[model samples]
Target chain A: MKALCWHGKNDIRYDTVPDPEIEHGRDAIIKVSSCAICGSDMHLYDHFIPTMEKGDVVGHEFMGEVMEVGAENKELKVGDRIVVPFTITCGECEQCRRGNFSVCERSNRNKSLADKMFGHAGAGLFGYSHLTGGYAGGQAEYVRVPFADKTHVKVPEGLTDEQVLFLGDIFPTGWQAAAQCDIQPTDTVAIWGAGPVGQFCIRSAVLLGARQVICIDNVPERLSMAEAGGAITINFDSESVLERLQELTHGKGPEKCIDAVGLEAHATRSLDSVYDRVKQAVMLESDRAHVLREMIYVCRPAGVLSIPGVYGGLVDKIPMGALMNKGLTVRTGQTHVKRWTDDLMNRIQEGQIDPSFVITHTVGLDQGPEMYKTFREKQDGCVKVVLKP
Target chain B: MSYSGKTSSSMSQSLGTSDKLARGIGWFSVGMGLFELFAPRTLTHALGMEGKETLVRACGMRQIISGIGALSDNPTPAIWSRVGGDALDIAALTPGLRDENPQKHNVELAMTFVAVTCAADLYCAQALHKRHKYPSSMVYDYSDRSGFYRLVADMHGAASDFEVPANMRAYPPMWAEFTPEKESGLL
Candidate 1:
């Protein structure tokens, strides 16, 4: 059962495959142990999500044990342990009865190929491809999962699959991009990408209160893990992330931006990331959204941008006149990770923040193709790798 | 009272990296079908379609017979023959989206890279035809599963009236010290 497949743009092999079982009836079969390599699996290892295939497999965070189940998985059993998440909900639809389990609508059995490209079609993630329901992931020693008592959670005992393997997706996508910036107490926020979902959106915008976070990034160990999670960094290649977020928010700017860097955002000389890297190297744009047009040219006005960053296709200069002349709002999707993987697994059981301190490398599942090229070239200091299996 | 063909619970399992992404899109359809069947006038002036060499060698013999039917080995009919050779390379690049093709934006960037490789060959030929529609030696015999056991037993009381709120249960990990040999002794 080796796994980590993907094979294309920068390939990814560690192959050997096949093992996952319980093909539905509320499937189960875990056994994985641990897994990680995420930053949106480098958008399916650089082929920026064209519904990956060529030996798909890959990963989606992970956790383990349960080995087998399906008899209609009554809240799972065989060995138990768990973690799972990476979307795939079915906790009884109507958007999992309003808690919006990542827009469930019956776990995407490739929901008309992501409703013919994004027109609506969400849940069903694990391994993230086939639009979103080709399942088979958790960088394998087993996997399967599906439904299994509504996409797993369990894990109880004294935690540590690197403290609940990121409740299966960048700590519930940096705590749902800082709890959709409802953050008030005095606000501030900002974010962008200091990697590993901007170090869990700088410790979930200081555990959802904000008061000041900032972040941005050019990488010095992800702006020193967003300054050890207290934030206030920047470095967008040396200052000027909209003039150092308007001199650190003293000019009424970051009331809550986020954008955790999606769609391969990398710009050195700007001009709209060199016209989104020559319209994404020729095929005229699929998405680059220079930090969503600089979070609509610096948030604040009405604030709350959010994003959670993974983005896939078609994006060309989006500012919509500063989101309708400074009244902003935005919010994004893909992270209904069972509405915040159980209060971020009780904030990793009360210690509040330590998601394996952005793991900087762990290796094993055959060193998943060299820890996916050392976590997509953020090499050596590789902000988060994990694997294990 | 129902059963004739495709069963093993209506398929969907096959995953050896989806037969290596349908044999790496059937050897990239036999290397873009032998460079558009023997370089049809240098692959129609390198995809800008100059006098379409006999319709690019008839779309390079349907991409070398769907790149040898996606390099054989049951990848759902070679990922539906590379989704019918990506709809015949978008019907031969839709006549260079007309306007007398003076490289109509290089035939709209070669039909937007063949509509993003025909949406990655129609998402890996509908995920290898919905994973070989159930029959990888069917196991669970859910006795012809009565509508998936009445939709997970009527979504178990609406998944317990939408749970997730035991005062956001902050430190509940005690299942007999959640074992995996004490989580591999905290690794």
Candidate 2:
């Protein structure tokens, strides 16, 4: 099997690796039909996440046909088509019972490592690093789906792979981010980042009845996609996000704000973003949380701040005073992928949104190495890249 | 059967090589601690650092503390404590390295052994420290209490009203009509 492996910083190789086999009674082997390069995967590619061994297979957003199943699995058969959630969970855990599958108490096999660091371990994630249980990802021809009966959702017959593939991570992540705002029909939502998750956030905010969606980004293509999702775009390079958002919201600022750009946010206009970049480079800080700070400042008093962005480590100089003084409510996490899959699937099935609209490029598995670089650099207007394995 | 629902054991059962090595060193500390605590004269004499039984006993107490700490829920601090103890051992054994007594060669051998252990201790200590500081790559970092667990507890409780709209029935332009390419032929 050929899969993308992380060799080191800035080094990704789509090379031949061992084929996956079902290793547990609740496991199943899936022949991946489609896989995607995600924004979070960029963290792994650039050595932003730790614990990636040289040959660890990479990729978490994928959907496929079941090739084999463990005997104890009751929900799925060998011939079923399914979308595997990025965060593996056991439906029986207390966390899973409360609909927080991303923090499933039982999934992380490397719980001790996580427990030592986090005081408790969360769920195991496919193709993520050892911090999430070191499970092999689905970037190859086949992958072992742990707790298959519990972690995978059966794709209905009518859907194309592209319509359902993102059910694994980003779509649900974007939806969860927007939904966390408790958007009212009259509320205005402001989002940072125009990447795929940000794009989905725009569409989701509209779906959830936001009166207006404001998207902030410097990328032309991503901003255009947000526009297609019925959002008003603010190019951070050309105009001030603070000024424009304040103007559009009648000086109250957006009632709902989403930070879709996680840790690697670049600042075109803000001097603080440049400082974040410099501090990140020198290891003075582990994450560049410029967008978070800006969102905290730009959001209205008592407004909801929802973060779909991925951030790791300690952030220096967070605007705690602003957050507290304004009575802001902040919500964020790894997407509880399973919690929203059913609703989003219904939306996709109903033509409410075509998730495929974000696909900027498509290629075979061999091009994965180059595509990773292309997606990371935002080259050729690449917002999202899908691979047919 | 299912890797999902089972609670992972804390005794380094399925941990990787590095964790296993750290546990191994931890057990070695316990053994050495017992030896020094129970037989300080015999243990100190063997290392060619004899005649200061009180210092040897104190070192044993430190080793026992560090060993217990290493095997605890968080081994990073304990591992570093072992590292500090190694530094002290090196400093204490320096005289043995130069003594003209017949046992000087024994001290040299012990120094070499301790040097190797120090390197291992440093490597494991740094690795554990990195893991402690940054659990994920820099992108998914959170403080000790700020990661997924607290985030879920704090935020999910607030968004409990979220649900798929009751009237959002499946409408037109079903999934079958969706296609990535412009040909519109796949459907």
Candidate 3:
């Protein structure tokens, strides 16, 4: 099988690897049809998340037909098309019962290793890193899906791969981000980062009935996409996010804020961003918290801060005083993908939203290495890249 | 299944030729700086400029800073700095090339190496700049991509049917008085 393998920092390779086989009764083998390079995958590509080994297959957002199924897995059979959620869950755990699927207690096989790092292991994630169980990802011709019976979302016949593929990750992720805001009809939602997840966040906020939506990003292409999705766009490069947000919300900060940009927030235009870059370069900080600082400083008092961004390891200089005094509520976690996929899939089928709008580039899986660089650099108007495996 | 006729050998790498060159120069800069810092007397004696060890050490520090910058995620600025340092190196070496200096040939050789490295730095810097250049027209119009089947205006609040899960709700029961349903008398 040919897969995109992580070689090192900023190095992904199109390599030939052995075929995946079912390792458990709940496991299934999928012949992947489509996969995407997620923004969080950039963390691994940049070598930020620790525990990634050489030659690890690198992708999670994928959908395909089941080519083989385990005997005890009655939920699916051969020829059943499904989108594999990034977070592997056991469905029987207490967290899964409470709809907190991302933290399902039994999914992570390397729980003790993760316990040493995160205090408690959350869930086993596909291709994220060893801290998340180190399972091989779906950016290949085929993949072995552990706990496949409960970890899959069945795709209907009518939808295209591009329309349904994101159900496994970003679509549900963005939906979860907006849902966490508990958006009221009178609320104003301000989102940072107009990347793919950020784009979906803009649309999700609009769909869920926020009175106004504002998106902040430095990339013009992304800002344009955000505007199309009904967000008032702010280019942090040319104008002030804080000042414009203040003016748009009539001087009272926005009622809800979302940080879609996570660890590698672009280091530009602000003194804090420069400070983050210096700290990151010196290895003093593991994750950049520029967006977090900006969101906390500008959010309305007692407002909700929903974060869907991926942050690894320790972050320095968070404004704890402001966060405490303002009485803000912070909601953050990996998306419990199953909790929202059914609703989002219905929306897709009902002609409410099309996930394909965010895909700006598509190519063969062999071009995965090049596309990683293009997507990371945001070059050639590349907003998102989908690989046909 | 064979997805592509092209094999791994034919695939394009994330690090292009110029990027690899910049990395090479960055390491070379570090190596050169270390030599000048720890063994400045060796360079000074070779060039017949025995009393200039301190100046060599200072130049070494500059090289190290520039090298670290060159090795960073965006190497264009650091590469440009190296070009500037090359000019300084040529100026500093010119004094050692005087007719009275016994090791003027070694100084000339060092100047030649610096000139070659300076050219490489300039080329790499320009390539990186061009690679990272933003599009001249700031915005690429994606206004048509509303992601909705109907007009975006018509799609606003389309998913009002969605109930925020109990654990995720922002406001308490007392705050329901301010809800849109209550405001519109629908409650």
Which stretch of 10 consecutive residues in model 1 chain B shows the poorest summed lDDT? B140-149
Per-residue accuracy of model 1 over B1-187 as CA lDDT, tens digit each: 1122333222122223555677777788788878877878875775567787887777777877777777654546656666666677778788777887676777778778878887887787786556434344433221121111133222222222223343222122211346676667864
Full ranking by DockQ: 3, 1, 2
Q: Name the better of 1 and 2 by lDDT.
A: 2
Best by TM-score: 3
lDDT of 2: 0.78
* Per-residue accuracy of model 3 over A61-114 as CA lDDT, tens digit each: 999999999888999999999999999999999999999999999999889999
Candidate DockQ scores, in order? 0.03, 0.01, 0.45
List of clashing residue pairs for candidate 3: none
Considering only chain A, what is the TM-score of each predicted structure?
Answer: 0.35, 0.98, 0.99
lDDT of 2 by residue, A1-389 (tens): 87878877656776788898778889999999999999999988767787789889999999899989998898889889999999998899999998899999999999998888678887999988998999999888899999898999889988999878989998899998887787776678999998889988877777677778899998776776677567889998999888899899999898889999888887856788888877877899888899999999988887888888988666888989999998887887888899888877776775566677677677777767666765777755577889888
What lDDT score is found at residue A346 in candidate 3?
94
DockQ, model 2, C-alpha based: 0.01
- Model 3 ranges off by over 4 Å: B1-11, B37-39, B53-55, B80-84, B115-139, B171-187
Candidate 1, residues A1-389: lDDT per residue as tens digits?
77778867656777687677787778888888888878888777778788787888878888898978888778888898988888888888787887778889898899998998988888888887898878878888888888878888888888778867887788788877777666655778888888887777766666655567878778676676566556678787767788778888776688778888899888676898888877877888888888888888888776768798988889897879888887777778877787777766765675555577666556567656655654576645567778776
Distance from true location, Cα of B174 in model 1, Å:
45
Indicate the worst ten consecutive residues by lDDT in candidate 1 chain A: A373-382
Residue A117 Cα positional deviation in candidate 1, in Å, after optimal superposition: 36
Local distance difference test, per candidate?
0.72, 0.78, 0.89
